[model samples]
Target: MLDALRIEIVEVSNEKVVARCPFMMQPDNTLDSFMGSFNSETVASVGSWNLLDMENEYAIGLEISANHIRGESEGTVKATGFPIHKTTMVWEIQITDENDKPICFSRCTTAVNKRIKKNNS
Candidate 1:
């Protein structure tokens, strides 16, 4: 379960994409207890590049293929982090073509809502 909540980078052929944010820890408090206690559900992800214990310093660089003949790209994600179930993040990648031209560029926001229990709680 922890594996799904972490940030990662995937390389396909000559392109690499990095996804990350700033967050750490699984439920310090149980949901059963949490649901039964608070007036409102407290859910949030603070910081860009929501990486685990490590600080959020995320980046991705890719090399264009020799012939540039690919269409779509994707990869299965296997990562580890805290708040186990949900991890919120935003990812952006710019694909440059020959002559340093931007062939494709994309930005996506994945809001995985992983619950966390702060010490103040």
Candidate 2:
């Protein structure tokens, strides 16, 4: 899905993660403004990316809520995720745009599950 949307990871750290998605119009020339699903995915991706840098656990999105303030028809948009709060098993991420604009504010809760290894025996 990320590939289809051309989402690119800009940066990642224990504190935050950043990503970019280019604006592309549909065949009808109508702007495919970043939708709720895309916003949700961005949040999840950032959170998961951060988790991957931290441990060998699988980060799965349990829940996400987004509030899109406005839509853009051109230029690339960037999403930055901040670790607002977190528990051992769950994390809360806040997303903002490149200009610090509230494009789609979201809170994502991710479940950090330990990776299980299969025994070849």
How many steric overlaps are in each model, in order?
Answer: 10, 0
Please write out the lDDT profile of model 1 over residues 38-115, one tens digit for every residue: 101111122222343433233222211122122222222111112322233443333332233432333333344334
| Model 1 ranges off by over 4 Å | 1-50, 53-88, 115-121
TM-score of each: 0.25, 0.68
lDDT of 2 by residue, 1-121 (tens): 8888788877777777777777565554333444444645565656665666354566766776666566555666666667765553233433344565555566677766777777799
User: Candidate 2, which segments miss by more than 4 Å at Cα?
Assistant: 24-36, 52-56, 88-98, 117-121
Worst window of 10 by summed lDDT in candidate 2? 88-97
